[model samples]
Target: MPTVNDVEWDLVGISEIRWMLGGLSRQRTNVIANTKGFPDPIAELEMGKVWLRRDVEAWIRDNRPELLENKKGPTPE
Candidate 1:
């Protein structure tokens, strides 16, 4: 099994998700985040919630392919 250090990490929070979803409003992002098919957050932290970037990207790829097609540039870190 992969150890913690061996695993690649690309975690994202609400703001990042907003950007990934093409600058969606916070309310819209929250709604989508709570949607039934959305990926469960990997953790809920003091700041907010976080998800694996890969998982969010996958969900976007499947559900909102047009967003990816119109991506302005690389996602911010």
Candidate 2:
């Protein structure tokens, strides 16, 4: 069995999630993040909340499959 140390967690923050969801506005991202079906954040720190990348991706897969197409990089700031 794999130990916790053996696992690699790909964590993400609000900005990263904003990028994942096709560069939604910060307000929109906050709305989506707080939606009932959205995954609960894995941790919260001084910088902000952080989530598991896979969880966010899974939510996208189920809720916003269209965004995945042509998903290459984050939108410019």
Off by over 4 Å in 2: 1-7, 72-77
Give Cα distance to truth, residue 30, candidate 2, Å.
Answer: 0.7
**Which ranges in model 1 have alpha carbons more than 4 Å from their true place?**
1-3, 72-77
Instruction: State each model's CA lDDT, in order.
Output: 0.92, 0.87
What is the C-alpha lDDT profile of model 1 across 1-77, one tens digit per residue?
A: 44569757789999999999999999999999999999998889999999989989999999999998786676779
Highest TM-score among the candidates is held by which one? Answer: 1
TM-score of each: 0.84, 0.80
The predictions' CA RMSDs to the true structure, in order, are 5.6, 5.7
* Candidate 1 lDDT (Cα, 0 to 1): 0.92
Error of 1 at 54 (Å): 0.2
Worst 10 residues of 1 by lDDT: 1-10
Estimate, for each residue in 52-77, the C-alpha lDDT of model 2 and write its tens digit: 88889999999998898667567779
